[model samples]
Target: MGFDGPTFAFHPDRRAQLRAELDAYYARLYGLIRDELSYILDPADVMGDDYPSETFRVLKNNELREFW
Candidate 1:
C-alpha cells in the first residue's frame, strides 16, 4: 500500500487533502449506516464507548459481508 517516489504522477499535490477527506467522509457515513441498521437485531453500538476497540476497530468505517 505504500507507494514510493511521487504519490501521484498526475495530482500529487492533493494527496493529503484527498486522503483526509476520504477518511472523514467514510467515518461519518459509517456512523450513519450503523444507526440505520440498529445492529441487525443484536442491538449493538458499533461506535461503542471506546471506538477502535478491536471489534469496531476491525470494521472501522467499512461494511463487511454478513449473510451470503
Candidate 2:
C-alpha cells in the first residue's frame, strides 16, 4: 500500500510471492499513468472498454448499453 523506490520483495509479515509480483506490476502501471492518463480521460465517468467514441448518440444508437 506504499510506493518506496526500491526493487525488492516487500511485506515483512506475509505469505505469498504473488502479492509482491502484483505490487510491482501495479507500481509500474501507476508510474506509467501518473500523468498521461488524466489528459486523455474526463475527470468523471471513466469506466469500461468504451473507447474512441465520437459521441454518446452513436453509442446509444448502436445499442451498446452493455458496453456503456
Per-residue lDDT over 1-68 for candidate 2, one digit per residue giving the tens place of the 0 to 100 score: 98879787755346236645665577587785733443333322344346544334453445455433
Query: Could you tell me every candidate's TM-score relative to the true structure?
Result: 0.30, 0.24
**Which ten contiguous residues of candidate 1 have the minimum total lDDT?**
59-68
Find the candidate with the highest TM-score and give its number.
1
Overall local distance difference test of candidate 2: 0.49
Clash statistics: count for each candidate: 0, 0
Ten residues in sequence with the least summed lDDT for candidate 2: 36-45
Which residue pairs show backbone clashes in model 1? none
Which segments of candidate 1 are over 4 A away from where they belong?
A: 1-13, 32-68
